[model samples]
Target: MISLPLFSLLTDVAVLAQHGPSDVLITGLTLDSREAGPGIAFCALRGTATDGHKFIEIAVGQGLAAVICEEFPATMNPATAYVLVKDSAEALAHMASAFHGHPSRQLQLVGITGTNGKTTCVTLLHKLLRELGYHAGLLSTVQNQIDEEVIPATHTTPDAIRLNALLARMVAAGCTHACMEVSSHAVAQHRVTGLRFVGGVFTNLTHDHLDYHGTFDNYLKAKKGFFDALPKTAFAITNADDKRGPVMLQNTAARRETYSLRGAATFRARLIANEVHGLHLEIDGREILFRLIGVFNAYNLLAVYGAAVLLGEDPMEVLTILSGLTTAPGRFEPVVSEKQRVTGIIDYAHTPDALENVLQTLHEIRQPSQQIITVVGCGGNRDAAKRPIMANLAARLSNKVILTADNPRFEDPLEILAQMQAGVTAPDAAKVQTVADRREAIRTAVALAGPDDIVLVVGKGHENYQEIRGVKAPFDDKLILTEIFAELNK
Candidate 1:
């Protein structure tokens, strides 16, 4: 544990009530009261759903080094110190960084934020840089990495304490550069408050996480907030094709740069060929053949390529390394049957825009005789506005659509399927069927496919567990699809 005097780590905080020693030492920091131990400082954060102030008393009783909150308790332990902060979350972030030795400043940190493509962009960049001989680290929804050591990721952006600890581990492991997906939740909650980001990338903005933000404008503000607070020394990279891309850099002090496929930008790419096998692109007058397919992935590649160029890497080598890179798991990953010529594609397309992009990519490349069958579902405890929209897109794009459950946390599986089925109109009703069981839905889709047919299993791409009623049971779409294919092919 790293212990420091209270004054040494204080940042814009005022001593409200000091009962005993003012020179009391703080050993560690935590936002959660359960983690409060002797000599640990507890930060009482006020959140939308729950107030951290409710647990400050418990921490103090447990012999916490100090109590940090916007409001001090009426009854304070005479031996424990109480400190007041303007913002509890912000103070926690600064405190966590100070306790961890400010590891972000020791490495070249690039943050990628948007509605989608964050995971793929950061994951690919990590792979690309590592392949180029740099000791790189990655933090994405899929996993976390410190050079060669892989750690399972529990959140898109971890809490301030955990984030600082992870960055410290990266620094200790001698990572030269690190790229992470900066979720909007992490931004609004002040998770990355004290971290220094050398660069930031905006992939795109769309309808997502409305369940938490409550409106589209609020969601946009949360994403734009990341760019707005960037330092002048850092670079702000955005997708030129997105309508809100330019708006993201409006108030930023950072240098602005753009990457696009449809318009002129600082970094630009053109699609030479988009086949099922892969995409051939003409990037900055140089042609590149990439193993990853689709227009969405094309945009992802441009974002990664642009960020690399902004970091002062060789343009030719970036493109060359980019061409050899493949997508992260569950992103347009294809598996074919041995006995039959049928193809099955896996993707994490939960949002309407993401779902449409995957389906459109398939329609553009498939043969006229091939029937496109899709198995898709919406996640529970999320933005419900996109459920019907996802259902409508599935019906409009595929010849046959199977609506099923995807991590129906507390909600009933049948209820979730019914909500999606509500989008099926009279004409669209003929192509749709409801199967509450996701595994059965996949089996049905595969059974219906002919030798030349293509099946698309969309949603929950890389996720291995199915969360139902708060229990995570073992369920992997990729593994299940492969097992069914082997059984059918034999």
Candidate 2:
């Protein structure tokens, strides 16, 4: 609904390429050429799988107001309007922010980025801030929220146009704060370009998105780019326990702060007791009990506490308020069936580091007689490098391990399972089994459990659908566990 002269947006970085009507009022913006129309600007970007530049001719044929691309497509018509920018994706971000009235500047926006705890940190921020009597907005992989409105999310970080638009809606709804998850893919591709963040939190970095970044250095660079671009006014809070956590803020101009459990830090926490029920932590100087369990939750709690303090909340009040809040959904969500005394934990740990963290946490708290059974899988079309590592970790850490499909996508489910099975060594081979069908995998895990056993279903937590061959079917791990447990008891 924002209308401005075409030249007003194009005058700075764009060069006219066979211009038609430079003063035409623009009404919409998009990066995909398929969405281009008479009054919309099409931003053609070079993506991982394909380049948006190839669809320029078809977009121009549809009479788009302007086609913003890198080289001004090879076949340019004299009557067709075109605006050439140095980088189409980056330009789209700035343009989209402008079109949305720069809502990020209106509210205090905090970006939480890292490999494991981005979702939990942001989710805690939104829920905590709202409970403390402030209107807050959330943009996370689990879902998107504008004050009280909930919207389904298709990506961890949405495209630039949708991202700005969502922020603008939050501003319009009178939101005073916004918490978002900044993915490496989004940062590398400049999806968060031109958005002002008041603060940025680094959870931790690990082996998750190697398929797109292609290398560890490239992945690290992409994460550091967010901190590097941060303004001096913004505060950078990081985990001092992670070796690379301090490295994340090394080049940033932002005021740096650290949070840790391993040693003394600007904001410090000590894990008093890590039980399945909750965690007892000594935060700053005061002892408090929190309902979130595990060492990973300890990191998440510290990050949330640090971020809340930087955002100008009272130190004690933040801890006191946080102590009552439960852990985010499907993150080590524990359930018990009435048939017998057994614990079934549903978590979203998929990466090697994340899986190891969860398994080690279990190893720390599990009783002498309590056994561990794990059902985990790597997603199709994702970091194939982690499949074997995840398999090996599950086999090594659990008394029983079931290899299953998380989301097969386009790859054959059995093929993905076979690749995972290759990681099981001779000693671990007797403990591992392949159940390509995820539901059956869950059922088998539940059936194999004893009175004092725990079944940890990792990967695809909080997700309600199973994606296979580009189609998403209904599948919920928590629901399946409850159904299986109930059916067996009946």
How does model 1 fare in lDDT? 0.91
lDDT of each: 0.91, 0.89
lDDT of 2 by residue, 170-264 (tens): 99999999999999999998899999999999999998788889999999999999999899999999999998999999999999999999987
The backbone clash count of each candidate, in order, is 0, 0
Task: Mark the regions of model 1 whose C-alpha exceeds 4 Å error after superposition.
Answer: 12-20
| Top candidate (TM-score) | 1
> What TM-score, to 2 decimals, does candidate 2 have?
0.97
lDDT of 1 by residue, 1-490 (tens): 6779987777534445445567889988888899997899899999887999999888887888888888878898878877777788988888888888899999899999998899999999999889889998899998999988999999999999999999999998889999999999999999998899999999999989999999999999999999998999999999999999999999999999999999999998999999988899999999999988999999999999999999989999999999888999898889889687889999998899899999999998899999999999999888888888999999999999999999999988888888899987879899999888999999999988998899999989999999999999999999999999999876
Q: Which residue segments of model 2 deviate by more than 4 Å?
A: 10-18
> Which pairs clash in model 1?
none
